[model samples]
Structure formats: C-alpha cells, structure tokens
Target chain A: MHLEEFAEGNSFIHKLDPRVKFLTVIPSVFAIAAMKTIAAPIAALIVCLILVILSRLDLKKLIIRLITVNVFIFFLWIFLPFSYPGEAFFQIGNLIATKEGLLHVLSITLKSNAIVLLTIVILGTSEVFSLSHALIHLKLPRKLVLLFFFFYRYITVMHDEYVKMKKAILIRCFKPKSNLHTYKTYAYLIGMLIIRSFERSQRIYNAMLCRGFKNNFPIISHFELKKIDIAFGIAMIIIFFSLIAVFENTFTQVPIWIYQKTLALVGQASRLS
Target chain B: MHISEGVLSPAVLIAGALLTAGGVAIGLKKMDYNKIPGVAVLSSTFFVASLIHIPVGPVSSHLILNGLVGILLGWMAFPSILVALFLQALLFQFGGLTTLGVNTLIMSAPAVIAFYLFSYLIKRGNNIITIVAGFLSGAVGVGLAGLFMGLSLLGTGEEFVNIVKLVIAAHIPVMLIEGLITAFCVVFLKRVKPEIVGA
Candidate 1:
C-alpha cells in the first residue's frame, strides 16, 4: 500500500547502498534501451524478474505493478503495429500490421517491462528519503534533492486537501457533466486548492525558518558501500552490457546475411531470364 | 504527456536531458530562496493534478495545469515539473526514470512559453480579456505539449504526419477542457488574490 512498505525487508537488496543501486539501475536502463534486438531485452526482463523475486516482494504487489505498466504498453500495441510501415505481416480491411511494427512493439514491451521491474526491485527497496540522500551523495544538485524531498512530503497532503474539497462539492449536489458548469466548478476547486497551498506554504516557510531551517536539507544518515555492493554493481554492469553486445552481434549479422542472400537470388533470376 | 522508457532513441534522450539540465540550472538560479516552499507546494499540486480527472464527453482525462504553474512560477516551472514528474515515475511508474528528461521538457517547456506569452495579458487586461488570455494559455499549453511530444517521437521512425495527427487529435478535448478550467480559475483568482498572478 505505502510506497516504502517493501523497503523495510532484510533482503540483500534492501541492505545495498542506495547510491550503488541508483548508479547501477540507471546504466542498466540505458543499456536496455540501447538494445536493438528482442533477445537482449527478454534476457534483461528475465534478470529483472529474478531480481524482483530475490528481493522478496509480495506477489500481489508485483502483479499490480506489472498490470499498471502493461496497461500503457497495451495502448502502444494498439497503435504502433498498425502505424509503422514495413513488410506486411497481416492485413484486415484497410489496416496493415507490419513486420517491423510488430517487432518494434515487442522490443518496447520487453524493454519497458525490464526497466519497470528493475526500478521496483532496486529503488523500491530504499525509503524515499534515503533515495534523495543517495541522489545527493551522487553529486546531484542540492536544490533538486530538496525539491524531491518536499514534493514527496507534501503530495499526500495536497491530495487530501483536494479530496476534502471534492467531498464538500459533492455534498452540495454537484454532479460532474460535460458542460460549462462542471468545468467552471472544477476550475474553482483547483484554484482554491492552489491558493490554500500557497498560503499554507508561507506559514510552513515561517515555521521552518523559526526552526533554523536553511536552504540545505541535512542528512543525518551516511551510506557506506560494502564489498558485496561493489561486486553487485560491477556484475550488473557486465551482465547488462554483455547481453546487449551478444544479441547486437548476432542480430545485426543476420540482417546483413539475409540481404546478401536476397541479392544472390535476384542475380540468378535475372541471369536465367 | 509522459513518454515511457525505451520509446526514444539514445540521441533524443541525451539531447533532451542536456536541454532540461540547462533549463533547470537557469530555473534554480532565478528562484528566490524564500520562495522555495511556495515552489514545493506548487510542485505537489502539479503532482496531484494528474489525479484530478475532468469529464469531457464519453471519456475523461486528467488535468495538467502546466499553464497555471507556468504563469505563476515562470522559469521555475522547470524545476517544479521536474520534481513532480520524478515522483510520478518513482511512485506509480506513470513515466520512466530514463525518459524523465524528455517528459519534463515536453510538459514544462510549453508551460514556460505560456507564461511568457500570456502573463502580461492576464495581469493587465480587462476581466473578459484576462479570461480569454487564460483560456488561450491553457489551450496553447496542451497544444504545444502535444506538438513537442510528436517531435520527440520523430526520431523513433514513426511516420511524422501520423504522429502529429494522432497526438493532436487525441488531445483536442483536453485542450478545450483545460482552456475552460484555466479561464474560470483565472477569473476566480483575479477576484480573490490578484497578486498571485505575478502580472
């Protein structure tokens, strides 16, 4: 339910330094994106799934995460295969699904699933505050890190405010319809929310200043990278890149070979004719 | 709209990240230290805005009041949107970490543009004109965002024309609804707290 619910586990992933997780996950995501063939991303997805299992995450939550991600990917499938122009794999009436398009969809699905699973397995194991700290340790801008912290802290508060406002409006017999009244009411609701937040922020700022708050958000916790953390980081990098490289070499060569074979067939046919 | 990971090429990703970094640097420099809390509050509002759905015909789409944020915060929309988007990606996977740069730029750049183009009108115009300006700001914000989304997808080998058509067509209702919402909000704010408009 809570974002940090799974973060408190004693799994090896939970104990790894957040900085190492951040560093490794980012590059792995990039490597997954850079992969040109389906096999690499499939491998990446399997690896991420294994990581998720090893992290001891609940099956229900994992399934929920996958469902949310797949909803978006489902839309991609609906549009991408029909729109991408290439060798036709199938046709229905006027719509044509291209070989290239289907391949593109497959690649995107695999890569996205892998990246999403990796993020949940890696970043989900650390508290939000610790993640910000890790970002700070990684030399990210202080302002950016503070922004993340404050945004995370206040998002729920703002959402609660919106909910209360909506409840009050609904109690007034306001039903949402597609018309001017609905739009105007919704706008005022949002306007009030913003104004309230603005005033609350002023008060909060004064309170913070009174408490001797400076621009910098101080982190009381320190992170130390253990030998296993370093080893895991290195191993992740190697596994991610080598999967890409291996598949890239094999897949890239196949296309060229197919092109040459087609060329040879064309030459023989022309000579015979 | 947020672009998911693995949807863009490395070239576009790097270019987007560099551009967003530059914008964020400027935004941070321009932000007042005392105003950081206000920015944070606005960032949270932006974060929750996506959950506020508005009914438009048969289907409903969520509000993305980037124009309002832009008009109020100016260049600070960059950092505000970045924070909200980062959290969205982290919490719900609505977007992806790898595509954060492109997603942030796609949403915030139009917002900043709306700020520059409409801030004066909203601040100085008569009541009706101010409303119209706000409407245009919101509509243009969504329109340009769709345009930018289409542009970002250009390098991905999709047909440029189809991408443009699809993006714009899907967002037509969103543009209209956001325009009305923005207009009403501007009118209300003008009546109650005009100074927040930063006119």
Candidate 2:
C-alpha cells in the first residue's frame, strides 16, 4: 500500500541497515522461490508472519491485503489439480481430483502469500528514499537508478491523472453500452493518456535542458552499516541457511497440517479395522 | 507471462540466465546515446501500457507489448525488458526472483523475432502494415510462450495438459486485447511522433 505506514518504527528489524535489509530480502525470496511443496510454503508463511510481527507493522492490514490476493488466486488453485494429472486421490461427486492437485494449489497459494508478505515487511519498514539510496550505493548502475526514480515519480502522477479522468467520465454521465463499448472507452482513455503524457514529457525534457540537466540523475545516501546491522545480517543469513540445510525435510515434506488431517483419517480407518 | 522458479528446470534456469546476460551486454553495446530520451519515453509508455485493461469475459487481461518494445528498441528491448521484469519481480512479485532469466527469455524471444519482421515491413514503406505486424507479432509471441509453457509442463505428466489447456484458453482473449492495444499505441505514436517508428 503506502510507505508511510512503516515509517518511524522502533523495531529491531526496522533498525537493520538498508543494505542488509536489501540483501536479506533477495536471498530469502530466492529460497522461498525454490520451494516446490506445500510444506515449505506454509513454513515460509509462518516465518513471514513472525517477521511481520518483528517489524511491528499493522499485521491486520497486512493480512487483509494478503488475503485479497489469495482470494484472487483461489480460483487458479481450484482448477489446477483437476487439470493437472497426478495420482488420483479420490472422487468428488462425478469429478476426480488428486491429492496432488489440492496440495499443488495449496503450495502456490502459500508461496505467493509469503512473497507478498515479505515485500510488505521490507518496503513497509524501510523508507522509500532510503531504499533507493541503498540501491544506488549497492552499485546498481546510474541508469537503472534514474529509471526507478522516474518510475516512482510518474506513477503517482499517473494515478492522479487516472483519478481525474475517472471523475471526468463520471461528470459526463458516460456509461458503457456493453463490454465492447467499455473496451473502446478503455482504449480511448489509454490513447488519450499516452498523448497527454507524451506532451508533458516534452515539456519536462525541455525544462530540464533549459536548467542544464545532465545525462545522469543524482541521489545522496547517508546510511552507515554499524556493528548491530552487521550482526543482524549475519544472524539472518545463518538462520536462513540452517533452515535450508538441516530443516530440508520439514521444509520439503508434506505440510504438518495436511499430515495431521491424513493421520486422522488413517486413525479412523484403523479403528474400523 | 511470468514464470515462477519451481515451474522451470534448474538447467533451463541457468541457461536462460547466461543468455539473458549476453543479450543485455549486446543491447548495451549498440544502444545510441542520443536515443536515451526516446528510450525513456518508450519505457514509460510500456510501464503505463500494462495498466490499461482489456475485458476478457468476466476477467480482464493487460498487454505485454514485447513486440512493440522490440520494434522501438530492437535488440535493446532485451535490457529494457530485463530491467522491467527485475523491478516487477521485486516490487510486484509478478515473477520469481531466481526465475527472472526464464521469464525474460519466455517473454522477449517473441519481441526479438517481431523486431526483425516489422523492420522488414518498415523498409518497404508500408507503415500501416508495419504497425499491424508489430501488433500481431507481440500477440503471437505471447501465444508461442504459452505453447512453450504448456510443452514444458507436458513433460511433467498428463495432468499438466489440462493446466496448459486452461492457460492457453485464458490467454486467447488476452492475446486479442494485447494486439489491439499494441496497434492503438503504435498508431498514436505514429501520428504524434512519427520519428519513434521511423528508424
């Protein structure tokens, strides 16, 4: 959502150096990305939840946003297993869906939710400007940095323009006649936006030239990686690797929750026997 | 479409990564410094283009315009797409961090092909045909990617066939919308600043 939400937190996670935070998020994301099973995603979810609490943000809002995306993904997961052939577990009515299908969907949902949660925690805690500065200090090329700056600068302007355009449409009592009409409306809107943005860009470029704008954009960073930040970075990496190595079984195995459900079913069968 | 890490083979990932690096290096070497402003403008066009939605049944889909990127930036589209995909993975989590290479290749290969095809049309002085070809090239590029994705999944087993079918079915409407979007954007640019497509 907004970066202002995570600003001025006293949490230890927030106090970590920007570079450490940046480095940690990337590898952590990569590790989570590598997980293929439902179990690892659920574990990652738990770990992400813990990190959210550690970061001291509004867990309620974070969760609500997370659930929104999950809801969108729910349909995707629902059809995947049925479409993806696996060892069929059982039948639902006339439909056959495999245990593997359900597990696959669950893994996708878990992985996605974890990734979103991680991003919120990182971006939420770190100041946007500070994060950009850290990116530059990390020796991300100046061009890339400038591109991001322009992207950030214009995204908001674009949003505001979209809002104004929506307001204009409302004022005009413009309602679409059908899906086709709606599309035409959208195409027209985009065309108009591009034209406007193009004209504005020209003005901006000319203004820059008049002011003697250089080929490069400038950013200033004042963050110093103190001992505490180093310790935080080391601790996080060590724990991450340890989780990867010794905990691989727990990470990659079927989820504990699912295992418990299966065991419950088995226990009932044994009693019947 | 964005490819998640777990979906791809490790070998594919490493190979895609190496190829992506090479493509970026080559793109950088040939990029014209004078065109920086124009490239920046096109990048913004791309960034905003994804925001415009086209209705496909109950769900809406957006354009990728990998073809337009190629037409505008040629081989340079590789680096441009790379940067966008990287930022997307980070900011929006659209693609996986480790699978960036695979995703880039999947999306950009079509762009490369489209660039050459459209460039041929431009030389013939057929501007409308060039624009339409650019649009169709982008749509087909995405379709090709979908087929490849399906094929990749097919290797996993029979169940993946259904998944692939659903994905392809879903993308039909998206492809159409993407084509129209690319055409409109190109035409508008053609009128407002013909120089963009003139090269």
Candidate 3:
C-alpha cells in the first residue's frame, strides 16, 4: 500500500540511526505529553514544525496528516469548551464556553500535533526494518523482536491476499450494504483469510525447518553507532527540555494573549449576531 | 479507535505501560519458537482486517477484530497486538508512542479476556452455544476496551465525564457489528477448519 512514504527520503534526520531516533523521540514525546503549561506545548509545536521541515516532508501531505491526527482533539473541542467549570470565556446561544475549558483544549491540540510531527520526522523517516532491528539492541526479548519482524513482513502479504479475495467476491456481483448478508459476507472473507494464513504459516515453518532454523536468528548486519547520531540525539534531548524550562513565565501569559486576540475578533463578530 | 497522544495523564499512562509490560512479558515467555511464524502471520491478518471499513447504515467504521484476535491467540494476543499496533503507528499513523501502552492495554487485555471466556466454550459447545459465545466474546472485547479507554481518560480529570460517556456510547454500534461478525466467523471456522479452532 506504499506505506511509510517518509522512509524513502535521505534527509539529515533520516540519516540518523534508528536506535538513536527511538531513544530521543520516545522520551521527547513523553516530555511533551507530560507538559502542563500552554506555552510549553506551543514551543514544542514550533520545534516540531521546524524538525518536520528539516526532514523535508511535503507541506500539503503534512497538513493532511495533521488533520487526520486531530480526530480525538476534534471530540475534545465539541465537549470541552462548554462543559468545563471555570470563568466563562464567551457565549453562543444557550451554551457558555469556559476559559479554562478552551485553554485546556488548546494545549491538548498543540501537544498532540507536536508529538505526532516529531515522531514523523524522527522515527517515521527511518526504515522500519532498522527500527525493528533497533528493538533488539534496546534489549527487548529476542522472540518479541523476531515476532515484530515477521509480523511486519507478513502484513502486506496478507493484505494482498485479502484484496484478491475481495475482487473474487466483486466478480460474483456481491454488493455490500447495511444488512446481515453484507456482514456475513465479510465474516466469511475474514475467516478465509485466517484459514489461508494458518496454512501459509505451516509452510513457512516447514521452510525454516528445512533451512535448519534455530531458536535464535543470526544477526548478519549491525548499525554502526556514528558520532553524528549521538550528537543529534543529544540536541533533541536539549530541545525536549526547552519545551518546559524556557517557557516557565510565558506559561500562562502568552497562550491566553494569543487566544484572546483571535477570540476577541470572533467575539466582536459574534456580538453583531 | 485509539486515544491520541498527550490527552492522557502521566499516571494513567505509566500505570497502563507497567501493566502492559507485565502482560507482554508473560506473553513472550509463554510463546514457543515454532509458534512464531503462526502468531506472526495471524497477527498480520488481523492488522489487515482492521484496515477494512464496513458500512453501518449511513456511516462507515473500520473493523477492530480484537475479539477475533483474542479468541485465536489467547495470552499471546498481548505481544501480537503490541506488534500490530506498533506497526500501525509506523505505517498508518493511527497511534503513536506515548499512548501505545494505554491503547495496547485497552485493546489486548479485553482480547485476553475474550480468549479465556470463550475459547473453551466455542470449542465444546453446540452450534447455537458457540454462536452465542462468539457474539458475547466479540461484544465484550469491544465493550471492555471502551470502558478502559474511558477509565484512562477519566484519570485525566472529571471534566472528561461527558467525553467518557460519549466514547462508550460511540462504541455501541461497533460492539454489535463486532459481535455479529465474530459469531458468523466462528461458525465458518468450525465448519471449514474445525481442527484450527478445536485445538
């Protein structure tokens, strides 16, 4: 399905080791997730935007990705503004938007976007195989690592098989609708996929056995831990700290100022209604 | 449907992560080397199936299939779902790292529950009993997942009361559809490949 579009690029971020990206991006995401203040997430968002541009992601595609990632935040918008208990920010019809509620949603929106962008730039740009390999180095159990490797390897194979079966159903003039028949059709299709996969697994196991498969997979290649990878990793750690440390005072001020300015314009327009 | 990153509190995130870590540990420990290929391929199938969007009246929703996954893999559903979710994040960006622990627990813990509750029942029951067990397992898997998601979000603040209610309510259609499909799928499995489910 041509997934992992960013993995094909060779930007500086892409050139960094997958293990290094994992080490840095994961903790950075946690730091972003844990940040309480509004300004902190704004700062994190700006840093992530810059990193995404440096990683050479397409602007249009990035926007599309952000919109897709905003589904949960969208739900927050629906309920938070009117439901939170705080000083009223504004009013529309019968509902009053709480200042605290709007502010909280804003911070969450920024934090969510920033974390996703950072992940796309850092881990998303690297080959997934390398990331799986990095898991081995990160001291995950060997079986778990091998399981991930094989799981990733077979998803596309199973997807292709699924597509073919769907086509066969289509040839039979099968029309899907909101009915039990449609649900049953899909159920049988999924059941067939499972059965096929089981048979496929048996063949795969036999093939491995014929090749003298051992309990452990032999590592033939290793990722060279380059100096630049470490330097870049440290740089990201510093950026992660600034998400909270540098924004301590602007913590409560800047975001309110920023939102108040925009909402002020909206407030003016709304009063005329 | 997984929770987006940054919405969950650190306490909820940490507790979820620790619990999931234990589950994955036990899951990995129990897995035999020979079963790796079987578990991997089956996990992949579930991954692909989850990507399929089926129409439910006016709207469409993707299949979750954690119920089916649980029925098949038992405790192994822990590691299986963990890997599948990790891949989903990398491939489709449906989820990310920070929420991985909570999301995995939300999906797989229910799956394990479904496994233990229905695996033996489906294997031994009559046709009607097997169907009922399958339906119950599928619905319960999704129902429990929704409850866990609400619980984790509740950890953020009580202000999330409305959202929590909405999340659980939103899963109703999914639960019913999951139940029906899993029931039919189980019937098909028993008829076509009894050994696969019987074992």
Best by lDDT: 3
**Residue-wise C-alpha lDDT for candidate 1, range A199-264, written one tens digit per residue:** 989998999999999787665767887999999999999999889778888557769999999999
TM-score of each: 0.92, 0.80, 0.93
lDDT, candidates in the order shown: 0.86, 0.66, 0.89
Which pairs of residues clash in candidate 3, taking residues 3 or more apart in a chain or in different chains? none
lDDT by residue for model 2 (B1-199), tens: 5665445444566777788777776776666443444455556657766765555766656667676677767877776777667656555556656678777776676777777776566434456785677568657766766766666556545555666788788777777766665666566666665665663
Ranking by TM-score: 3, 1, 2
lDDT of 3 by residue, A1-273 (tens): 777777877688888988898899888999999888798899898888888878888778778888898987899999988888999989999889999999999989998888888888888898878898898889888899889989988988999999999999999999889899999999999999999999999999999999998866677878898999999999889988766767655456668999999999999999989
Question: What DockQ class does candidate 2 belong to?
Answer: acceptable
Clashes of 2: 2
Candidate 1 chain B, which ten residues in sequence have the lowest lDDT sum?
A: B155-164
Q: Which CAPRI level is candidate 1?
A: medium
Model 3: CAPRI class:
medium
TM-score of chain A of 1: 0.87
Candidate 3: regions farther than 4 A off: A216-220, A248-273
Candidate that beats the other on TM-score, 2 or 3, i.e. the better one = 3
Q: Please identify which of the two predictions, 1 or 3, would achieve the higher DockQ against the true structure.
A: 3
Residue B127 lDDT in model 2? 65
- Error (Å) of candidate 3 at residue A47 is 1.2
